[model samples]
Target chain A: MLEVRGIQTFYGNIQALKSVSLSIREGEIVTLIGANGAGKSTTLMSICGVTPPRHGEILFRGQPIHRLGAEKIVTLGICQVPEGRHIFPQMSVLENLEMGAYLRQDKAAIKADVDEVFERFPILGKRRQQAGGTLSGGEQQMLAISRALLARPTLLLLDEPSLGLAPLIIKQIFEIIRKINAESNTTVFLVEQNANQALKIAHRGYVMENGAITLEDRADNLLSNEEVKKAYLGI
Target chain B: MDSEYFFELLCGGLVKGSIYALIALGYTMVYGIIQLINFAHGEIYMIGAFVAFIVSGVLTLTGYGGPTVLLLAAVIAIIYAAAYGYTLEKIAYRPLRAAPRLSPLISAIGASIFLTNYVQLAQTPDFLPFPELITDFDFMEPFSRYVSSVDLVILVVTTLTMIALTVLIKYTRVGKAMRATQQDAVMARLVGINVDRVISATFIIGSALAAIAGVLIASRTGQINSAIGFMAGIKAFTAAVLGGIGNIPGAVLGGLVLGIAETLGAGYISSAYEDVFAFGLLVLILVLRPAGLLGKAVKQKV
Candidate 1:
């Protein structure tokens, strides 16, 4: 339930998202695999209204949200767990969770969801009183996801959750992502550098180069494709 | 010199430093949370003194019978100052929170200038007398030639306020939120902090402390005017920066150090250039420790 068409985003005069387009449907895990500076983060940023697209439309469930502010877009059930986790470092894990549900009015549901986050990431529960900055990279990543989940958004934007984690932790994180999508029917728009893990979880995938979607296909077929093998899968 | 003379000097400096620390707390708290200096804070102190001026005058004029009337006056002054600080934040700083860096700062300067001029117009730019209840000009000292009961009262009041602020930032939930917000405003916002509101509350608390300092200083000196805020504000800001601009205890340490230095500089160095001693200390200390004495350095990775 998302649509982005011909969006142009810029930092000063340098265009980051150059006339890009993409879409995602409900209950689907869509992946965008790209190298550094390929504008993957910018695409997510544009959708979440952190960097409002200069020349495009972003529709979530057929409502225009391109003009909305970042927090307003969050209220519309679109949440972006930014690159680098961006967890409030000085806040405790509990306080970070509280902030994630900032826009929600239901205090009871919020508390329940917080419990669920603590249940899923019991490490966070054990360290609830400690500042988020003190958590390890893997734990911080888990806290970040749990925090975004606290928003109770229909769509979750994950950018590089596995960036600095060990292989085992990355595997566990990916498995959890799968579990979340299956259980909650949440639409996940994931951007990643690890094409293999991303492709395995994604229903459909897009390969981006220099701010444009260069290839789009079913994850399995793309994994077996010769160019995909050579360029991304390393098969 | 006798221990009493040295003890008295120490007490006197410590007392004045406590007032500086109280005012410095406001500067440091606002700076800690938003990294923005609320320049109008000094005016909040000025306003608090006026609030005490009005409240205590009325209380004593009505023959409010109690030996504890001075304490009551202090409490009223604190509340009035907090309200003034909160209002200033809501009106001047809150609206410009989203504006660029320089905008809110300018607004703060504007607020400072506006209040200075406003208080001047309202109170008539003349030096006003502090309330006499706490001053007690009738009582002369024993074995003390320079230090008065007025100075002693000021010391007591200022010391107590600083201790209260120390307990606050160290132990309170809201204080934790303030530190978090100060550390990272964007992340704090994402986590659901109404940062603007927290900042306003900080201003309120800080200004309240400053009001205590203002009242104590006014009562001790027995002369105040619109121009008084300029010197007090500058010295207090210097104290904040000296102890590490964002550290609360640092401000107190800085204030005490600065007060002693200034007093000594006036007595032994040059009374006409007492302010130069404060400025010189600030510059010298900051040059050595860019973050000030108690400030920890921050590292950001790109």
Candidate 2:
């Protein structure tokens, strides 16, 4: 479980996140949905220690992780697939996946994980030797997810997985996310601008406005909530 | 135009190119990772030559002369240069990681100046004659007219070093981590890579290469001074820019091209314009292709 309490994050003098708070329980898919620049990605970034919150604390399984660096946070089994996918453009798909398992030293297990990832995403396997930049948007997204999955993270942070992808590929990606959570019992904190799809798969959902969380409820409730429907869902 | 004279000049150019390539690598690799020019890198090379000079001199005076002393001197110089490089980064550039780009570049220049003056104060500012470490080989007697044993050794050593570097970058774990870090620092962190360590490793490796070049060049030229790194650093930086600042192969090509052009120009045209040829080519490259030979113009994502 991850707990974020009244965290304020900033870029220079401008506050990007203002006393925002959220929590996710273990083995559940919790999503934070908002429009562009509503501080959704900032929340994940704060948790990941890329841009540590200037105020408040973040606890992972009761351990304070707010002061830790991004590398330390990853070593503690929290891995992030950041917004824009941040795949190493010149590295091959397989190399990107290898980087995902960078911290793991058990060569056999790492190889097994790589093989399993390839089996799950055959397209990635087919294009394993191709540079990550050469992959299409959907394939790159899959490769990004596969890369993060190779980390064998207990807590996976996904930011806008469906961004710039086709509707069919988006559905496939959502299915993969659901399956991953169910099978591995991995806790997921997904940040998405696609509120409808995010709410459909999430166990609980939080609606964010500006730099703070505005509403939190069961996925179905948030899905049908009048304000959520009007503002995020566009129903 | 005599063909024998042309061959001799070509061999001489290659020898110079090998040294430039070795030094240029440090510039390119460091730039690839941090986008800093690392002006102090030349100081590491100069320190390498100084260490080799002192070690070899002491060893010969202490009644231990010949190939083993030469080998020991090179090894010591490499180790010392690597240590200096590691310390230099920790002191100069690492503290300014979060600062503006210009900050670290300025720090690099400051470090370069500091090291140069430190060497001058520690040793002599004047050029000291370096002993001939690489002796002539009996087998090389036949081809000595075209290529001396020293030139052959330089070429062979440079070739081997380059091959080893290529292997390290292509297949090794740390090398992969370096490439990953170079491409995306944030993502490299997310994947549990300690990017600071990668940067230090880069500095160490680059410094090692420069040290090799330093020792070889000192032995070949028969002299070294505290200010030697200033000119060599500029030449290597020019080579790096010529090859495309961040590309490894580009640096090698740039060094060779610059060396050959400078040598050919000096041999054929007036020798006074040796540097003019180097800078002229650079200006031409900048005017025609601002990205350098192998550099791609990076498109900024808005």
lDDT of 1 by residue, B78-152 (tens): 988888888888888788766787988999999999999998998778888876666444555563455677776
- Listed in order, each prediction's TM-score against the native is 0.81, 0.97
Q: Evaluate candidate 1 and give its CAPRI docking class based on DockQ.
A: acceptable
Residue B170, model 2: Cα distance from true site in angstroms: 1.5
DockQ of each: 0.28, 0.63
Q: What is candidate 1's TM-score for chain B alone?
A: 0.89
Q: lDDT scores for all predictions?
A: 0.82, 0.92
Off by more than 4 A, model 2: B297-302
Q: Isolated chain A: TM-score per model?
A: 0.98, 0.99
Alpha carbon lDDT at B80, candidate 1: 85
Count of steric clashes across candidates, in order: 2, 0
Q: Which ten residues in a row have the lowest lDDT in candidate 1 chain B?
A: B135-144
TM-score of chain B of 2: 0.97
